[model samples]
Target: MKNGHITQKIGFSALFGCMLITMFFLGAIIYFTVVRGIGAISWGFLTQVPRSGMTEGGVAPAIVGTLYLTAGSILFALPLGLACAIYLCEYSPRGFFVNIIRMSINNLAGVPSVVFGLFGLAVFVKFMKFGISILSGSLTLGILVLPIIISATQEALMAVPHSLREASLALGASKWETIRKIVLPSALPGILTGVILSIGRVAGETAPILFTAATFYSRRYPDSVFSEVMALPYHIYALMTEGTHPEKQTAIAYGCALILMVLVLGVSAIAVYIRQRQRIQNA
Candidate 1:
């Protein structure tokens, strides 16, 4: 018994140590980003366009472009992904083909972002003749995150109690009605979780947009979907790799990273808040 007790204690200590290490690394990243970037962040930095060959000025265009791309990706991906998930969970027959399709989606989710970028370049940029534009980039990102959304949504839908579905159908509601009125509502929180994750992924992705949309330096803001705009991730990369003035651009790059982090966190926090409130209401 003493030996068992000692073993349990050691196991607890190891798990606790791992948790501490994870937290330490996370905290270190946040701390360094803030410390290095905060100095460059200001009202002007947030609102003005870059100036003097991107050596000086703000990242307003990049911020706007990121927002545009993120929104476009969500809009493009959500409905289609949700529909596919619904069909899979509610209608797809349990068979070899269904399993194969599921496996394909899972594999697609694991595909490299760079490969998606190449695909976007070939399909959206070249074949479609959309050129290097926001539409092409947004579509590419939408496709990139589609697998994630579909997988999460499928899990969420499957998690809905079969009994609840039966009850809704038994109450004279049609299958579609049951799904729309009961199942979807019940699974919204989980769906939103997928959205939250997708937003983070979509916002941070540089590779997918590199060939399809991002331009190193664009003076004008994107006026339409066809416009090639500056994006934060690409902006930071350009600053670090291609800028003439190192110190200033480096500071600005850090600042851009900080802003991107904040944007993602802000959006995610809002999603989480909504999810929690939904749980409370449902409870």
Candidate 2:
């Protein structure tokens, strides 16, 4: 018994040490970014167009463009992902076909972002003639995040209590009706959480948008879906790598990074609030 206790203590110490290391890294990143970038963040920085080769003004257009792409991708992906998840989790029988679909989704999730960019360049840009526009980029991001959303939604649906379904059926509810009424509500929190997380990814991704939509220095906000636009990720990349004035551009890059981080964290916080409320209500 004494030996077992010693072993458990050692195991816990190792686990705690790992956790502290991870946390320290995360906190260090946040601290470094905030300390380096906070001075550059201001209202004008958030609301004005860049001037003088992008070293003299704000990133308004980039902010708007990121929001547009994020919204468009979510609009395209959520329903389709939820539908696929429902079919896979509830309707499909356990068999070879289902296994194949599961394998395909897993494979798709493992695909590189740059590969998706190339695919989007071919399919959406050349074949479909979207022409390096917001619509093309959003469609590409939707495809990129589809596997994630579907997997998350499937797991959420599967986590619904089996007894709830049985009870609904016993009460004369059809399978579809039960799913629509009970299972869906229970799973909504998880689905929304997945979607919110996907939004963060869509906002930050540079590769897919680089081929499909982003331009280096657009001053005007995109007027329509067909218009190419600026984005924060591409903006930061261009400033850091290609700008003539390294000092000013680097400051702008750090500022953009800080803004992106804050935006993602804000959205995540809202999602967490909603999820907690849902769980409370369900309980």
Candidate 3:
């Protein structure tokens, strides 16, 4: 009995230590980002248009491009992802083909972002002739975020009680109808959370867009989906890599980092609010 208690205590201590380490790493990252970035953030930095070289510009175009990319990616990914999830959850039989698809999606999620970048460059930029444009980038990011969205949506759907599905069926609802009305409504909060999380991923991505969507310098905002645009991560990367003034570049990078953090935090807050509202409504 004493040995059992000692073993349990040791296990608990190990788990606590692991948790502490994880929190410490996270806190360090947040602290550094905030401390280095806050000084560089201003309305002028946020709103003014960017120019060539680190010393002369703000991230307005990059911000706009990030928004465009994020919006476009969400639009492209959401429908396809939700459809894939619905099909998997509602329509697909628990058979070889379904299993294969599930495995493929899971595998796709593990593929490196750089590989996705190369694929996007080849397919969208070269074969489709979209060039290194926002459209190409959006398509690439859409693909990247799809697996996440699909998995999350599938989990949400699965979480809906089987009884609810049975009730809908007993009401003479078709499978599609049940999914659209009962399953979807119940899973909407989770679905939105997935989307918000995907938005965070899309916002911070550098490699995939590096090959397809971003240019080193863009004096103007993208005029169309097919136009080359500036993006925040790419901007930060460029500044860090190519800028002549180290202080200016570091400052800009910090500022961009700050913006990225705020964007992610804001999206997370909204997702939480949405989930809370959904819980209340469901209750």
Best by TM-score: 1
What would the per-residue lDDT of candidate 2 be over residues 1-283, giving only the tens digit for each residue? 9999999999999999999999999999899779988988999999999999989899999999999999999899999999999999989948899999899999999899999999999999999999999999999999999998998899789889999999999999999999999999988888888888888888888999989999989889899999998998888898899869999999998899899889888888877887788778777
lDDT for every model?
Answer: 0.92, 0.91, 0.90
Instruction: RMSD for all candidates, in order, please.
Output: 2.1, 2.4, 2.3
Per-residue lDDT for 172-262 in model 3, tens only? Answer: 9998899889999988888988899899889989999998999877778889899999998898899888868877788889999889889
Which scores better on lDDT, 1 or 2? 1
Candidate 3 to truth, TM: 0.91
Count of steric clashes across candidates, in order: 0, 0, 0
Residue 204 miss distance in model 1 (angstroms): 0.7
RMSD to the native, candidate 2? 2.4
Residue 215's C-alpha lDDT in candidate 2? 92
Highest lDDT model number: 1
Model 1, 1-283: lDDT tens digits are 9999999999999999999999999999899889999999999999998899998889999999998998998999999999889988998848788899889888988999999999999999999999999999999999999999999899889878899999998999999999999999999888988889899889999999999999989778999999998999999899999978998899999999999889887778887887788678767
Which residue pairs in model 1 clash with each other?
Answer: none
TM-score of each: 0.92, 0.91, 0.91
